[model samples]
Every structure is written in C-alpha cells, then in structure tokens.
Target: MSLRTQLTEILPPLLPSNPSEAIKGTELIRLARLQLNGAYSDASLRYHFSIMSCDPASPIAKVEKGQGYYRRSAPVPALTGAQELLSLSQGRLDDLSSDHEAVDSALERLRKFRAVVTRYYEVNGRFPYVFRQAFAQGASLGNLWKFPEVVLVDWETGDAPDEVFALDPTMLSLKQRLGLPPFRLHAARLRIHPSLASFREDFFQALSASMWAQGGELIYAAPVEDEALADGLRRLNAIFGVGVISFGLTAQALDDLPRAANILNAHPRETEALMDRLQINRIAAPHTRQHIDWQSLDGLRRESEEVQHLIGWLNDCVGKGRAEAFRDEA
Candidate 1:
C-alpha cells in the first residue's frame, strides 16, 4: 500500500502500552516518520531573508555600535508540526473503529490523575511530588493529558506486605535502567485508538518523551496540538469521585486544593498521618509510584462507569500481558 494509505490504516488505531510497546510499534514509527517527512521540512513560504547593508556609523552609530547586529533577525526555527501527526492518526483511527468507550475512559483517567496531583498540593502544602521533582528541573504536568498513575503510586504497593506482587519484571528492569519507578504512568498511560481492535506487542517498554517547566519546576510533557494547556491541570478538578481517600475533615477539604494544602502544610503531621486515616488502597501518592492496581480499580469504580473502566483495564492489561510474555521467555 502507499505510505499515505498505510498511514491512514495505522496511525489512529493506536493503543496505549508501556514505553516498550509505544517505542517498538513499527507502523506508528513509520507513520510518524512519514508525517514528519511530508509536512515538516521545506514547507514554509520562502521569506525575504537579507542582511541590511546600512551605514554602521550614521545616526545609529552616534548611539551604540553593537545595537545594529541584534536587529539582524532570522526566520523561526526549522518548523516542526504535530497537526499532521495527530490528524493522520485521528483519521486512520476513525476509519478503523466506532468505539467511544476508550476515549471516555482516557478522558476520565486524565481527570482523575489531575485531581490527585492537585490534591497532593492540598495535603502537603506543595505541588505533587512528581510535580515537585519536575520543578527541580523546571516543569509541571500537562493539563490536557495528565498521567495520574505516574504521580501517585511508587514502584510497588504491598497489598499483602511485599515479597509477591503484580508488575512486569521486564518493565521493572527497563525502568531501573531509565531511573524511573515502574509505576502507574508507565503501567496505565496509553496511545489509544478506541476503535483499534488489537494492540501492538511492544508499546510497554519505550516511548518518546518531552519535559516542560512551570512554577519553577520540571514535569513530563505529552505531545499534542494545544500548548496553552501547558499547566491546565485545573481541568482535573472537574472529574468526579477521584480523591475519595478517607481522611475525615481532610476528606471534607479533599475536594478543595487550597483547603487540603492548608491542612497538610499547617499540620505537616497530616502527611504522615494519612495512613492512619485511609485504607491501603486509598493511600495518597505524590510522586512517581508505579504500583496502583489500576486494572482492579475498575471494579471499585461505580457501576455506571464500570463498563468504560473495564475497557481501560483491558487496554492496560494488554501491556501487562505482553510484559509477562516477555518475562516468561526471559
């Protein structure tokens, strides 16, 4: 098939996987390369670029001699656009399926992750730990596609008190290699196309990434069209039933970022006291913890949301299964 048609067939039918799956999807890599090649290079209208040969010592010379060179402006950087990338993917995905369940699931999870990040501020009187860590390098979470799992759970949660657990040994190794916790973000984030019938086996281990800055902190960045959502984490507040962790009056204030932060900041003890106030599963995470059984979380969510929740679970578990497959062969 033609590259364009191949792109139309593959890009949008994407599914989320761990870094490995994302990176190894040959079709997506192919499409990304094509989209970049077709629309990115040498597409801009040629602008009249010239160095002005003005008298360096006229009226301007009377003021400052160095001021002239700063005016020798040049065109913008070699242009790179994600529109074709997103559109090409979107078009291909639209043709392949009619499911909205995955879209809703992703949107809801995005919302949940946002709330948790904000709640960390309320509970600790500071931004979420991952946010803080990112800030150390100058960044913040993307508002549009927040990966809640990454910021909340660490590498593993001991539901039965350590020893045995539910994580991909293969993934854990890669994460160790990359200096990241093998946690929720890697486990739950997806490059999903709701209509895509199957998944690529390699998405879980690798993917491209960018970093950003806000409030003097560093955070992970997601690729997309809108840049304004740079810090639009506030959109997360609109998601319902996310931070249901039981913390008494803290729960009362849990819905409010400022109020929650006030309590945590005022009584720094509350941060540590959280375990006493909530269940193991309700544990609050502020950094990149990898262990939240987001797959099981679907069972805990309300019945109305269960269908979509399960869809998300299935999408994520597909990666886990692949990771396990890799582990079994290892």
Candidate 2:
C-alpha cells in the first residue's frame, strides 16, 4: 500500500478528536512508525501528515492554532451547515432529517460562530453592528442577498468597551470638507463551511448584500484547505473586490467553544483564552472604497427597518461626539 494510504488507516484511531489535546508532529510520527510496514524518514512522514490534513476526505486534520494533528470529524450531511440553520429559521424542520439532534448541533455551531466573529472584531477595535431582524423568523429568504449579518464600523480610534471616545470637531469637519466620511463600513457574510459547490453563491451573496457599503467580506469558520476552492475564491475576489477570510475553525472546534452568550459576554481574560483557539487566515484582502454608496444606502434605508435602526445608532454616536459599541438594547 502507498504511504498515504497506509497512514490514512493508521492515523484515525491514534489521533485525538479534540483540538485542545492535539499531539505534536514528532510524537505523531513516532507513534505512526509503529504501524508502518517500511522505513520512512521523519521529514517524509511529517509531509504526508501536513498534506493529508488538508483533504476533507482524509482522516487527519491539523490544529489551526497550535502544533499537532487531530482526527477529522466524519462528514456531516449538510457540510456547510447554512441550509440547516435556514430550514430551522424558516420553520421547515420537517424538511430536514429525522435526526433533530444533528439539526440542533448545526444551529448551535452557527450561533457560536456568529458570536465569535462579533467578539473578534470588538477586541480588534472594529465596532460591529448586527442585523438580527434580517435573519429572524418570518423574514424573507431574499434578505440573505439583501443584507449582511454584520456591518463592521472602523472608527480609527477607540479602546474602552461601551466607553465613548471623543471625535475632534476640527478633524470631523476637515474630513467632511475633504468629502471623506468619518468612518468606513464593511458588510460581512458569515458561513460555517467553505465548499467549491457553494462558495460562488456565498461570494456573490456577500457582493449583493454589500452593494451599499464601502466593501464586502466573506468569512468562513473553517480553513480554506482545498487548493481549488482557494483559487476559485481568489479569482472571484480579484474581479469583485470582496475579501475572503477563514478562521481556521473546524465544525468540531466551534462545537468546543462556550455557548454563544458566554462567548459574547466573555471577560478580557476569558476572551483571550477563546481567541487563542483561532487560526485566522486572510485568503483575499478586501478593496475598500473611499466612500460608501450613499445612494444605494438611502434606497435600502427606505425599505429596511433594521437599516433605519443602524443609521439611527450611527447618528446617535455622531451627535454625542463619541463612538460607542452597539448594544441590542441601546
């Protein structure tokens, strides 16, 4: 048997399923050798592990945040997990499998991912505005194409949470005179998986939703491990200017995270602990326009009550001469 074929059979039972307890390359190599039929150098064994880890069909997976390998989870039927959430949100549970446990698991992973994405931006100095109503039950499915789940506002300066940082009147006026908006907004579309079949749909959905924003981003919970999938995403990005990023999170890793509420409300120390688990990779940089498409935004504002609330929040911040994080209650 080929080395890769041999290793495939050898790795799964030997590998840990949890990412936190990932075994180092050397340790794995030593253990893998025990089952080997022929001589193989450490370099050769390590190379096979790295390469095989990228294949979804392969049993081996590399930890994104640390040094080690883990057993990849068996493929879930709805690999992307988006459709499961969509079906549940639309109250079409009957359309899904009779395995309601799997459905609930998918939904929890989706929710946790959203919370992680939100907290990731918050700690990184970008203020996030969530559009819950767009995804709420009874909302039209078309909203997926028309609205981003989150709008990231970069105010250029701020530190304290919910604490206001004064924007200088002089600088604000100067920016206005220069025809530059005081801040930039980038609309983001989040997905739990990256697949060749569905990525184009994912990319264009982000593009369609971000027509009114400065730029657009497509964020994935898992790594863009497949070369073909990565290349396809890059080609689309080159033409469309929408950014692509992978959090290096597998479905299993997301499942290991704290509940969505706990992730969102994590204290600094706890947040850091959570952040350490991520392996962030930027597949393509977003091309941010100098100005937002205000005309398109105005048109949207007329239709979406959520958009109106978003604008109202921004206006409140500007009026107060300080930027504060968006609170659902606020």
Best by TM-score: 2
Candidate 2 wrong stretches, greater than 4 Å: 1-84, 87-95, 158-164
lDDT of 1 by residue, 246-320 (tens): 122221222332332343334546544542443222211222222434444343333223224433443453445
Give Cα distance to truth, residue 107, candidate 1, Å: 18
Provide the global lDDT of candidate 1 against the true structure: 0.27
lDDT of each: 0.27, 0.81
Deviation (Å) of 228 in candidate 2? 1.1
* lDDT accuracy of residue 302 in candidate 2: 92
RMSD of each: 23.9, 5.8
Model 2 backbone overlap count: 0
Give the C-alpha miss distance for residue 67 in model 2, angstroms. 17
lDDT of 2: 0.81
- The candidate scoring highest on lDDT is 2
**Candidate 2 local lDDT, 1-330, one digit each (tens):** 999999999999999976678888999999999999999999999989878876768888776554787776664344323443762232222234567787788789888999999999988878899887777757677888889988999874443454446665776678879988888899999888776546777898899999889999999998875554677789999999999999988977988899999999999999999999999999999999888889999988998888998998888877887878887774
